[model samples]
Target: MDMGGLQIEQDGQTLRILLSGVWGLPSAAGLDRRIAAIHAGGVRHAVIDTSGLERLDTAGAVLLHRLWRRLAAQGAKVEWPAPRPEYRTLFDYVADSGEGKVIRPPKESGALALVAWVGWLTLFFLREARRFIAFIGRVAESAAKVALQPRRLRLTSMVHHMEEAGLRAIPIVGLLSFLIGVVMAYQGADQLRRFGAEIFVVDLIGISVLRELGVLLTAILIAGRSGSAFTAQIGTMKVNEEIAAMRILGLDPVEILVLPRMFALILTMPLLTFYADIMGLFGGAIMAWSSLNIDLNLFAQRLQDAVSLKTFFVGLVKAPVFAALIGMVGCYEGLRVKQDAASVGRLTTRSVVQSIFLVIVVDALFSIMFSIMGI
Candidate 1:
């Protein structure tokens, strides 16, 4: 029931603050107001006498700490002459833990803030590019070593990742690719019907799906799924210091972790792409039959004429390259992860985004190269 209060008295150049009553949560509001009303502008020395305090808790301890800092900042040298044994530990904890510090926001940078931000971003990009190049070199060197001694390849880990990244991805990839095919056919038929060439919808679906969408969509799915998984798994290991332990024991973390996932993706991506192509074609053919009244035979026959071996191989060749990018980026970000749970999540998201972006870029480059080559 006792309200906390402080009485300040000044004598010449010195100030004294004597605290009394129950200094707890219930009295925190009154104490704060009272402290705020004090004027310590030019006092050279101040003594805080806590002997009159009837009770104290963490909340009151924090307020006392705040008051002490406020007076010090106002040009007064503050001192707590003799804190009681019961309050010493709490007061020491509050002071040492910086419970009274105020965090100020950064000053405004005005109109030039955008330019400064752009410059900082450019620098960050260049630095990350250098690190990525170095990471790729290390991966290539490790790959060459494994290629020389095939026995060093960890087949167990490779198989596990293959099942994870490839076999298990079949359902979602197949379903989505099939749906993409259906939508593409339906739209193509609607457009071609205007020109009295609904039958050409077969050519549209076959060439597009076999040559582009099937592999591209499948790679995107894998990047979001398997690529992010790689980052999270390895980042978590790094956070737990498991990666460091591997190095300490003379084991290569790159060889043991990165190479296996990389090789698994390289081996499985092409096969998954092929599966996606078949599923896509099947969906397109079904829609073609339903919408354009084209039978399975006619659809298949036209598909053969529209999509050649070159077309299929063109898309197929890009699968390994895309897989390598996804695997390398994912593992690279994972290895770069700092020792924290938050870093794992952040780097995992970065891995997925970077992998997808690089995949799309590489696909575009491939398209340009194939065009120039007249294939």
Candidate 2:
């Protein structure tokens, strides 16, 4: 059987066209050739007979409408013979909806557009901050409840997340800290050698690594690694409607999901920061002994004299706060994900970026506070 076809005939000034079979996307190419041939004929007036059409769809209706408009534009009157009511309705709907109109973007001045964009961004930032604070409060309340009734704590989930976020992260964190220590020592030695202050390179390495670099770098790494993972995992759950199902089953997702992860990160961060400090000091010691003629014993002595317990505590004190920030930001972005795969990826990236930014800002604030307190 013929799938679809268009036939045209002309008698003097009037052109009669017959549409047959199914008219849809599959038949569009052939219909286009036929329409083009008819247009080339320069027929003045046209009548489209759809009574012969076995099936008509939006695609076919759109093509027919285009032909009608073309004829009308060229000083020709186009008419449609009495057809099935459904086909007529479909044709009229497609034609009158202005689907074929070209949409042009509105023009605006650069300065005005910039101002509008900035205002929108400021409002969005404020809204996000409010939502984040509310989420934190909910998490805190759930955590307090768990603390009062320790049995309610998801110990197994917390342990699992601890292994994933902390244990699994050690190698990368250690290696990066070690490398940073080496670079810092080498650079310090080079600068100090010019002033006959090479021995002070040990002081520089110990103070900087213990007080700033170790905890800060570790937090940044955790933010990128575990933070992004948390967002992606929860976002996937959101996309799959698992969160909704949990709610329907009377489960609080915050207690089950967010609190455990938050607790795990908090418990593990101080330990990780201490481990990073040790590894970084070891790396710097190696560089100092090899390059600056400062043996391991001499380097140890200088480090002991240069870095105080207060300096060590200053870095460790920031670890739990940084971990909390990373965990909250990651889980928050994950829960914010919409029901789409693209949203999962987008929010996961956003989680890592936002967590890192907030961690740095918080670290700077701690630095100011420490300086003021003379710690």
Models 1 onward score TM values of 0.75, 0.78
Model 2, residue 147: C-alpha shift (Å): 1.7
lDDT of 2: 0.91
Ten-residue stretch with the least lDDT total in model 2: 34-43
Superposed by TM-score, candidate 2 places the C-alpha of residue 53 at a distance from the truth, in angstroms, of: 23
Off by over 4 Å in 1: 1-111
Per TM-score, the best of the predicted structures is 2
C-alpha lDDT of residue 348 in model 1: 95
TM-score of model 2 vs. true structure: 0.78
List pairs with backbone clashes in candidate 1.
none
lDDT by residue for model 1 (11-92), tens = 9899999999889999889889888888896999999999999988999999998888889889999888878987988888
